[model samples]
Target: MVLTLVRYIREKGMKPGDKLPSIRTFATELGVSQSQVRSGCLRAAAMGVLKIVPRSGCYLADVTLSGIIGPFTLLFEAMYMNVQPPLIDLYELKTTLERGIAKRVAVIRTIEDLAELKRLLDAMETATEHAEMVRLDELFHEKLASSTRNPLFFSLMQVIHSMLRQSRLSYKDFVSEFPQSRKDHRALYEALRDQDALKAGDIAEQHSNRRKLLLVKNY
Candidate 1:
């Protein structure tokens, strides 16, 4: 009921400060009991999507970035509640977004961004075990996202990171067994630093594809 109402308002392109339909009118329009409409409205308020003022009408929430992400966070939580492995489709999507971003970063990254990438690479190099390597790898990508200077991209990457955290750490053992990633990172860092977009894109795609392949082969 709550989701239905929320979806309707969203479909209408309503924004914060917009007034919702009155309870009685909304109930009649939706052909629902007034109690049901009221319940839905109340739940929407709890979900941070609407606000009800005493003696006044409901209004859309002035949602913060976290508030916007809240519903999706809950959805992902429900998807992972059983500790099942994450879907490969998500990794595929992540790789696509990352490779595209890496291409752009390679072409347009600033000197400071390259320096940060190098620092992250060095940190990854020093990490001796799976756990440390996983942490460093995440930092490496965070630096990559920062190079793009898009906060929404950074936020999405964080969500993607959380989704794959376990698989990523587990896969680090396979990554650590080979020196490929180290060599790849060096080439990748140089390519980006030199603004060699094509080389950087190729390396980024190869790196991501290799990781995906390793996951498939081992687990």
Candidate 2:
């Protein structure tokens, strides 16, 4: 139904801000019930493909990357809920992706990117609250990914971060290893600053492995 509606919009040459057919009209034209049409419209609206205007009508919205990924966000949440993968598995996946991201960032990170990372690191260093530290930790990694100047890497990290949040895993869980983690982060940052891609990648892998070991020992 969503596909049909999107196709209909495209077939009609509808652009953003263009009004869509009424739900009843869509239902009749698509040979679906009004309820189904409404549901499809609502899904499209949520995906940013359309906008619901209350009593006014539905209109096309400016499509964006976030809008395109919105539906997948729900799917990701559902998968995590059902599968409940081990923390080690999540750590492994994060490590694999971040190793490459670190290398790329080391080669291409700009001055501004380094400054942002430095800020996040400084904040993390002083963060006494477990929750705050975890938040800062995630932001530090996100900023590192962004420094790679690859949108796809950043998006993938965002998805992984979402999964971590859903699993309720916190940096505090690895408190016994916090000191090493801090040192690893600092070293990784220096490696990037020096444009030492290989060193950065090694540090990223070691950092991930250490966290995985901690999780295993504790949980």
Candidate 3:
């Protein structure tokens, strides 16, 4: 159903903020029951594909990493509550994925990508509030993933970041390592700028290990 809606949007060339057909109209057009259309729309909303506005109408959401990972955000929340192993496993998975992403990003990243990464890095270094720093940190990683030019990598990183955000408050102590993290990001960015995939991978491993240590100490 979500795929159906996404296809519909694509076929219609609807941009973000473009109004969607009313539920009844969509149902009739799609030859589905109104209930099914509503369900599909709600699911798409959960996945960040559609926005539902009360007293208004549904619209296409901006195609963003956050929106793409919205359903995973909900899934990770449930896993965090009901399953312990999955949370740990998710960290391991992210570690493996990001190392590869870092290497690929290094080889493929554009000048514009480096500029955005540097911008985020600067924001992180100067951020006085813990929350703002954390937000910038997430954005920095997201930008790195985007530099890889792999939509799957970007989407997965978005999900992992969202899941980590669920427990960020409890891990405030990790913010104490912000200075070191900033240095690591700078090194990683330089490695990427140099287009040295091997160096990028090594930096990624070091960065991931440091983060794992922080999680171990804090958790």
Candidate 4:
């Protein structure tokens, strides 16, 4: 039901914050019971795809190409696959992506890109909460991917970051080394600032491997 509602919203060309049709309208057009439509709306809202207001109608949540990746991944797992990708597989793919991002971003990054990355790192320094630290770290790498001026790269990194977030929650012993990670981010930022492609690539790989070790060791 949730998937059906999602498809209906997409088919209607609805965007984030746009109001969906009335439940009665949806039920009549979709040939579903009103109760089903209500349930579907509730389910979709739970998935972060819809926003239900007490007095107003359901609205689409903030939409992004990256935001849809999580749903697609789960749909694939439930419909076509038996299990999620192993941690090692996710690490390998992310490491490769980071290596490539470092190589290109070092050469392609503009002054503005560097500044944004530096800004994220500076925020990391002042961040007091664990969740804030993790969110900033995600944005840091997302900036690296975006600095490459490749939409594909940025979208892929977002999905990987999402998956890694879930993985982190599952690994009870996978404590974060935010301090060391921040230092690595500083080095990466410097490498990009210097336009040192080779050094940036190396540091990116090393950083990925360090996390890989921590994850597996704790697993």
lDDT for position 189 in model 1: 89
TM-scores of all candidate predictions against the true structure = 0.80, 0.69, 0.65, 0.63
Encode model 1's per-residue lDDT on 1-219: one tens digit a residue.
Answer: 776787788899998899999999998988899999999888778888889998999999898776766665555455667876454666676678778778889878987887788888877767777777767777787778777876656666777777777776666465555468778888888888888888888888888777777776666
Query: Which runs of model 2 end up more than 4 angstroms from their true locations?
Result: 1-45, 49-66, 82-85, 166-173
Q: Which 10-residue window of candidate 4 scores lowest in summed lDDT? A: 73-82
Arrange candidates by lDDT, descending. Answer: 4, 3, 2, 1
**Candidate 4 — which pairs collide?**
none
lDDT of 3 at 156: 76
Q: How good is model 2 by TM-score?
A: 0.69
Q: Could you tell me which 10 consecutive residues in candidate 3 have the lowest summed lDDT?
A: 78-87
What do the candidate models score in CA lDDT, each in turn? 0.77, 0.80, 0.81, 0.83
| Tens-digit lDDT track of model 3 for 104-200 | 9987888899999989987887788778877888888888887777776777787777767756646877678788889999999999999999998
The residue pairs in collision within model 1 are: none
Lowest lDDT sum, 10 consecutive residues, model 1, at 169-178
**lDDT tens readout by residue for model 4, 46-120:** 767899999999999995766666665555344424556577877898899999999999998898998899899
Across residues 1-219, which tens digit of lDDT does each residue of candidate 2 receive? 777887898899998899988888888888999999999888878777889998999999998665666565554555667665567877888899899999999888899999999998888777776666667878988888877776666776777777766333444465455667788999999999999999999999999888777766665
Please list all clashing residue pairs in model 2, or write none if there are none: none
TM-score of 3: 0.65
Better of 1 and 4 by TM-score: 1
